[model samples]
Target: MSYDKTIAQAARTELERRRSQAQETARLNLEGFLSRCPRAVEIRRELSSNASEAARAVVSGGEVRMELEQRKARGLALREEYDRLLKSQGLTRRDIEPQYTCPKCRDTGFVEGRMCDCHRALRRSIAYRQLSTGLPLESCTFESFSLDYYRDDPAAMKQMGIIFRTCREYAENFRPNSANLLFWGATGLGKTHLSLAIANAAIEKGFGVVYGSAQKYASAFEKERFSREAGEGTAGDLKNCDLLILDDLGTEFPSAYSNAGIYDVVNDRLMSGRPTIISTNLALDGLEKRYSERFASRIVGGYAMLGFKGRDVRVQKLNR
Candidate 1:
């Protein structure tokens, strides 16, 4: 999957930083160890010289095998002595070596000409972080959501309880091709909160998630529409993300282009069998009136509706 240049650059820079830090840390550790144990330093020097001698013997071609075998024996003895010195100080060989976060790539972000898993993960995380910017992802978890705000009406309480449990289960069992969801309710009814919770879970499970308010994405689509350049848009990210969370679906400024763009995104994701969660203040009737019968009907048929019923939680909090 392709990410924006900024995201990719940031990931690469971070990986390089990790690699340098590991090397610097190892160098410092070795310096400290040498300062404490001078004899170990001498043994290390002897081992280095033995390796150089072995190399020279290989090229000199005078009883090469015997000379190489002698050098190897001396090198092995020097190594044993070095190990003994380290053992006396309660240290091991690896203690003075660079300990990278990923041994496979040594924090280089690639191995054998292929991008490392760690590198891909870093890019995905950076992209998700950028896409989810300004949203309270850390605080919008299922555990932090309160049921106390829905206590005003019995029907509302019962409906909210079911919605909470169902949302939690959906997040827990989320997969790439999981069922699409429509969160229909009024403002502050926990629709956005639950959708963000699902995004957090999917990200933790290593799925690439793109989350944004409808207004934000609509503005992106509008901006990208006029800019007729290759690789110059956010729509690709919206369509290709493993999971998409479109919050406040009916809130964006309406236009022919924006509406069609939104419809295209929804339809493309649906056609590709990718899971999407759409939280909206619009009910079925409101959705049909705003978009089209086809758009509304596609949602109605494909998405499992989770009706949110409760007093405005934000207002409740403010009152308290």
Candidate 2:
């Protein structure tokens, strides 16, 4: 999949950070060990020089073997002296070598020039974090949702309570192949909150989540529509994210271009069997009027619908 350049760069930056950390640890430990065993200073310098000489000796034919033998003899003698010296000081040979966090990859986040699994996972996590920045995510968790705001009306309370529970369960068990969901309700009724809660959960599971309000999507679509070849396109990523949460549908300025673009993104995801959670104030018929009959069908066809019926939580909370 094509990720944003910033995503790939962030991944590389993270790998570099890990590598630097590993190197720093090695340097710090080496420095500490050298401070304890002053004789290791000589052996370290000699070994470093031998490493360079070993490369040069590769071109010296049989003389390389003779040089290698001499280096080996000297190394053995140094090791013996160091051991005896450490015995007196109470330390081992390993106590003087550079220590690594990962012996297999050495905290490089790669092997054979290919990215490691840890690196890929980190990139996906970073991407989700990047996308969700400044989004109102914390207010929407199931724990924050309350049914008291629905009113004492038994039917409304029961319906809203069930809806709230269903949304909570859905978000709790969310996965890439999880079922699509529609959150239909009036504004301030917790639609965005629940969708964001699910997004938070999905991201916690290491899934890549894409979230944008209808206004944001429409604005981007309009910009992309006008500048077809002028800039990068993010539409594909929107349609292909592991979980897509499109909030505040029906709020964007209506336009032919944005209308089609919106349909394409939602429809493509639906057809591809990718999970999407759309929170719209528009009811089924209103959805048909603003979008299309086919689009409305796509939402209700196989996807589950959660109807939010509570009064404005913001208003009720403020009053309380």
Candidate 3:
């Protein structure tokens, strides 16, 4: 269960904020309660003194058992009086205590030296939100992808059904070293939709996924080349994410730098044995011509090719 460092840090920061807010609220509640009832303050002081005296009795030794018993009785009496006073004021202990969002960990993101489930959930949510920033992740789930679009053509419908099942199974069983995937076909044939669907599943399973269009990535790479600070971390993220989805692969503006950038990212991930899913409107020959023979060969040899088949779903929808 690996997560991006930035995402883990963000989760920690959020947990810290929750803890602070809970503590602050608790302090204000206690302050207000003490202000309303002066007797409660006296009882609180007596309870503290009783605890100190019990500790001293243990160290002093003579008649320690008896002295400790007396102090314990005094402390219990003080607590009972405090509780009765709170009841009179229509309050309970919880009303003056910190109310943490995750009580099991007290908003600390951990329990007994281990990461809590709440923390893991928070990281997954943050990762998903970050990936969905410019993408339609919520709408591109497997359940929402309709086979009805290809119903008119029997051949197209059969092919799409198999492709859909394969993509869903791949996502369900995805691992760090899972096989790479290439989605190749014409526009609006459900390539990008399935790619994002896979991304959504991988993220839900706690894998870091970087998803974006090839054009967007190319622009980031080109900006990084000229400016030292621009997109400094973008290349690293692209290479290191557990799953990378490069959508519309042939849509980027043609340039030497963008070509090299795309090649580097694809080659690096392949060499590292990390899984990647790329959707392209280009075929083998088009990929070879647009990038290079080597780039095309790497993808062909390493990726499980899924050739999308169907009329343009977008066009079909618009016409309808």
Candidate 4:
């Protein structure tokens, strides 16, 4: 999957930071151990001297095998003594070794010339974090969503409860092949909230999610279309993200390029079976007029449609 360059860079930086931190921790641990047990320092010095003496005996060629065996036995004894010292101080050999975040890669982000699973997960996390920056992810969780807002109308409340339950279930069971969702409703009907909540849940489950308004994506497309920046294709990131949530779909300024771009993203994700959630103020008929009959039909037929009905809760909140 394609990722934003900045996000990829952030992941690399994180791996580097982890490597440096692990090394620093090991350095500090060794320093502490030496300070606590000066005998460990003497043992290490003796081991080094034994190695130098073994090299000298090899050069002298006088009973080198016997000399090497004696040096090896002495080195083993010193190692045992070092371990005893460490154990006396409530430490082990591992205590002075670098503890990498990813044992597979040792925080190097790669193993045997291939990207490690930990590195891929880090990239997904960075991409999700960068994409979710301006979104109200923390506040838009299922727990924070209120059925109290629709209480004035019983039918609205009931439908909203059902929608809320379905959305929660969808997020709970979310996978790469999960069903697409089309949230069609007026503004302030909690479509964005539920979609974002799904994004949050999916992200917590280690899915790569990209959530943003349709207008925001359109602006990105415009920049990519006109700019000279290399390898900065926003459409690729949107299409390849594990889950894409597009809010206020009908609010973006319509143009031939943007309309086609949006269509391509929707169609590509649909064809690839990558689940998407689109929250829009447009009905099926309105969608047909704004885009094309084929695009509208594709959405209406392929997506699990949820028509939200309620007064604008933003105004209600203001009055309350």
Q: Give the best candidate by lDDT.
A: 3
lDDT of 2 by residue, 121-223 (tens): 7777887778667886666677876777777678878888787778778878877788988889888887877788788787777777888888888888887
What tens digits encode model 3's per-residue C-alpha lDDT throughout 50-156?
89989988998999988988898899999999999888888889878999999999999989999999999999999998878878899999999999999999999
lDDT of 1 by residue, 1-320 (tens): 23466777899899989999999988887888899999988888888888998899888888999998999899889888888888887888787899999999999998999999999899878866875677888899999999989888889999999999998999999999999999998899999889989988888777778887899888887887867568636777778878998989999999888899889989999999999999998999999999999999999888999999978999999999
Best by TM-score: 3
**Every candidate's CA RMSD:** 3.9, 5.1, 2.5, 4.0
Candidate 3, pairs of clashing residues: none
Q: What is each predicted model's overall lDDT from 0 to 1?
A: 0.88, 0.77, 0.90, 0.89
Q: What TM-score against the true fold does each predicted structure earn?
A: 0.82, 0.78, 0.93, 0.82
Q: Could you tell me which residue pairs clash in candidate 1? A: none
Summarize candidate 4's per-residue lDDT along 1-320 as a digit string, tens digits: 14556777888999999999999998998999999889999999999999999999999998999999999999999999999999998888787999999989999999999999999889877766765677777898999999999998999999999999999999999999999999999999999889989988988787888887889888778767877365547788888888998889989988878888899999999999999999999999999999999899999778999999899989999998
Two-way lDDT contest, 2 vs 4, winner: 4
